[model samples]
Target: MHIITRCEEMKIWSLRKNKTPMLHYFLFAYWFILLVWQNLGAGGSANRGGMDVVIKCGLLVMLMIYYFMHATGIRRDILLMCMLLVGVYAIVKIEGGLDLSKILYYFFPFLFVLLIFGVGWKFELNKRQLVHLCNMLIVVVSYIAVYALIFCTDQFANAFSIDNAYGNELKSFLMSSHEYGMYLVFGIMAIILCMEFDPEGTKNRRFWYFLALILFSVNLILTFSRTSILSLAVLLIFYVLIFAKKRLRNWFLILAGIAVLMVLVIPSLRNFFWEIVMKENNDAGRDALIDFGMAFYRDGSVSQKLFGWDYAPIKAYLASSRGLGSFHNAYVQQIVANGLLGVFIMIMYSVVTLYDIFRTIKTKKEGSHLSKFFISFAASAVVFMTFNTAALFASAIDSYFMTLFTVVVPKYVNQSIRAGTFDVPIKNRETRPNVRRVYR
Candidate 1:
């Protein structure tokens, strides 16, 4: 057979075994594109450039395709239709026909994820074949984390034409200033990598995973994104405390490594770390943005205040408010644009999700730490928004992190473990003579 024919045969064999090559490739592609987006910004070769647009459109198309292929019954179809309708309404109300960054990049992913996966994507990911796909994804993400830490440059700073001083400080750790949002996504990936590649459990894989974490941590500090840093910090702490077996030893070493790294490689990072905890000067500016954001809520016209001044409105408002206006808070931005209803819907959805996942964690006997890590990442993302406004927005990396954690990771892990046919052993009453007596 020709080489092409031979390759096709292999592909067919893989698919026949129930392996999802497309989804694995897609996950890898997403991770790779995110790395490029973070490092290369939104310009350049058509394939790599305008990736923010590509990611949104690609995700929308992918999810829609997945929905049609995987749709179960009438209920899912109806729910998806309603979601699409709401998205369309919000899109029209916000920008009519997808012209604004806020519409295409910010809002679409949420709608797409909700419609495609909300009904039962969780069940779809339960297959063993799908779990292997997820493991492949985690490996790919670990690779990206390591790559981002080592090769990433200040390309991001020059892309946005941000102030040189800030660039000088930030560019060293960040891949791209223009795509700092993606950095938060990277942070989420790092958490997953850690969860899947546990040291004691996973054996040799632990070394690479630990290295991945260090690289990610360094990148987070170097990126100087308060949101990413804080999110990762919260996530790591949760993972170590709740998930890490031999908890005291594991956490102590992890903390010691971080402390030593701060002391040795970059002393300045210690200050940066503390600054995160204390919310210092630079942090103060962010709070001021919130204050001003709230003022818009308190002082703007009823419509502007209630319906949200919109991104454009904020630019217009800012063009007048000391030559600038920004809805620097994401939740506030939602309240401003969609009114209390939009905000309430968002809160309700998030609360429901958290409750469901936590319940799932409690009931499922499989990987509790993995579940906790997944939950922590998702929860951390929701909390991260209080510091930065992009958590709800499509283009903002926070939403990506949220979707990945809430929708992707859990489904991927659960399905993979289940698919592997690894049974969670139930104690057999026959084996334990005292079991019945104890129970009685």
Candidate 2:
């Protein structure tokens, strides 16, 4: 729980009012490398133990080191805060009489996020650059989509067992469908934002973006991951009710009606969708995991509850269950991995984020209609990560785009929305601050 979050305000959320941006051109190459590495199918071993982890962590360290040469406000504060976290973690291990070498495996992987936050915390971008970033995210999805097409041609070809009803789940290159599903959530949102914000002067761009959006949605559904599906559903509802245009809402409703009609009229489709939902709806494993986690916490020593055990402590349970690994529940997973203090920090982070989002909705400027929209995306993204994902630190791709959208890009959009600059004519723009204006 030693987040030292008071330090969050020590640096702004990386939003600056500068007209010219400090470009990190290396990011594009970095992201492309991540994309290829992930889809290379090296499996979790590659991700967790191989040079992949070293390369990622090393690249981030280099970036932060370079950043310190010119860093001032947010970058410095955020990096120092991250160092504070590492200090707290090390102190807990040393004071708790645990071997730091044994826990280093658990500790080092998390440094990637800390390093990324240090570099990205105060990173700046113009509106056009943000749109380009989102476009690149869409390209990530497009690559995955094509990969899915090539591999999951049957959509149900990769059956687990004869007894397993949820057959042929689309995992793409990922071993778990949920990871791919989570990856698509951010990609889907990126497409939506890009569709709304990307330059419109280019011909047929909307058609292509919309087509990609449809494709991404289909792939997500085919993942058949309950948590991911629910996460996307919540995000879509937030978009429609809070930010979408009336016509768009109506269109969404119409599409819903058509989808329902097709499901009802087609017996096979209805059964398939129903089976996807009910496959493990009554699975007792999750409840049992929760029971075990709570029981362990209640019976453990005070130190144990403060910092979790290095091991899963559920190896017996794992031996009996088929394909079941760690706890599927994120909160329980956090409790087992980092202990009660970790869960407390996680919950407190969400509380802080939601409170800030509430303030954003309450204090929108007169003409900043999309402020609520931007805040809604940020809020839903935070909620989805806190409740659904097993880890708060995202994959390399999601880390890049999510940080850009939630923390880096919103200030520009919210400000331009307030100035009415996006919708205003070019002649009226002289009165506004000298910064990038997203023209409608």
Candidate 3:
């Protein structure tokens, strides 16, 4: 077998008779559009009726073609496991008397999961392409952020004021402040990873990335979502401890100290922290929701306990006075919708993904770009799953990126390992400083 560098692979692909590389770029652009305009309807509702069907169907077709044409191999076990889980859920939905339309809606997640896995497993991009994609994401998100700051700031202030006099959270174009925060988190990670992976550029490149970082960080803070804040903090700490150079680490510490000082010294900052931590009472609401879900499960029959009550009943229950319209936690939601089996499947995938990431980190050289991005993305995924439900299983924007990274990073790691490129430690490498080498 002949091993090829990413640049060489890209060149070869470009010269191929097939237009698969162009198709991949198109798919990436489509995916990016999906992420940016995920919630473009009134009151942050996703317009899932009109063009959404067309987009999804188009994606399904493109993905099938791409997979069959380019995928060198497939993970049969993973594919089969996913199919089995989806099959069980479909059967359960039918048994519970859900409408075909609603059942089809339920199937969207399964399709999305499959599509993401397929693309991640099959499609490959070099460092330059990946960085270009990230740049596109940053530009789109930054535009959205700037638009929100200019047009929506007053609305956000007014909305927050209704809840508390001092509240000033910004939700942007997303459904919630938390959702916007999550978007910013991904943008931040992308900017940071692109900077680290392809750093041998002009001074202007560094300045732009630094500016983007500041923009993303400011928007994240303005969202005022505790989960997002905590997640960002964790990502920064992970990067600083695991990937940052000594000078960067020292600067990070100094910035951390200053943030702490501001939190302590500023009255409004102290009040904001208090509001988020103490006065919000989110834990109580979350606890009640969890208890309700558990009690509902305990009262279910054996079949329901095993295969779940499906979508209709769950929807009705949530619409009822006793339910909160949301499970408030993804794990709990899975249990309610698909029972213990569903939860098991999700947990299995998460465990496998984390295992792969850890394995890559251990085997790959320190400062490996793929490994670092994997760690950053994995950290974000963990935090996103901890607080939100839609990211992994749904066909939303966040889910798109999550699925893309989840599949691509592992494939890249495997390829690097197979080529023996990951075996050499960073300190031992004698590569040129100007060239960025990565797997395609």
Writing each residue's lDDT as its tens digit, candidate 1 over 128-225 gives 33344445555654555455545555433232333322434343323343134345344445545544543344475656555655654554455555
Q: What is the lDDT, from 0 to 100, of the residue 221 in candidate 1?
A: 55
Prediction 2 global C-alpha lDDT: 0.58
lDDT of 3 by residue, 208-272 (tens): 78887887887776676777788888888888887788999999999899989998899877766
Residue lDDT tens for model 2, 1-440: 23222323355343323232333344555556655665574455436445566556565555555554433334555556557766766676555365433344345434544443444433334445556667777787788888898867777353322244455568887656766776688788877776665557334587877788788888887777776677777787888888889999999989988988998899766766666644647553667767776786677677667876554335446547635666656667667667887677556544544554455456565434445556656655555454343444433454454444554355444444444454543333353223232333
Q: What is the lDDT of residue 168 in candidate 1?
A: 40
- What ranges in model 3 sit over 4 Å off? 1-27, 35-38, 41-54, 97-105, 109-123, 155-168, 276-281, 320-324, 365-369, 406-440
Each prediction's whole-model lDDT (CA): 0.51, 0.58, 0.63
Better of 1 and 3 by lDDT: 3
Arranged by lDDT with the best first, the candidates are: 3, 2, 1
Off by over 4 Å in 1: 1-41, 44-55, 74-110, 117-122, 126-165, 171-204, 248-281, 299-307, 316-326, 393-398, 411-440
TM-score attained by model 3: 0.79
The best candidate in terms of TM-score: 3
Model 3: ten consecutive residues of lowest lDDT: 10-19
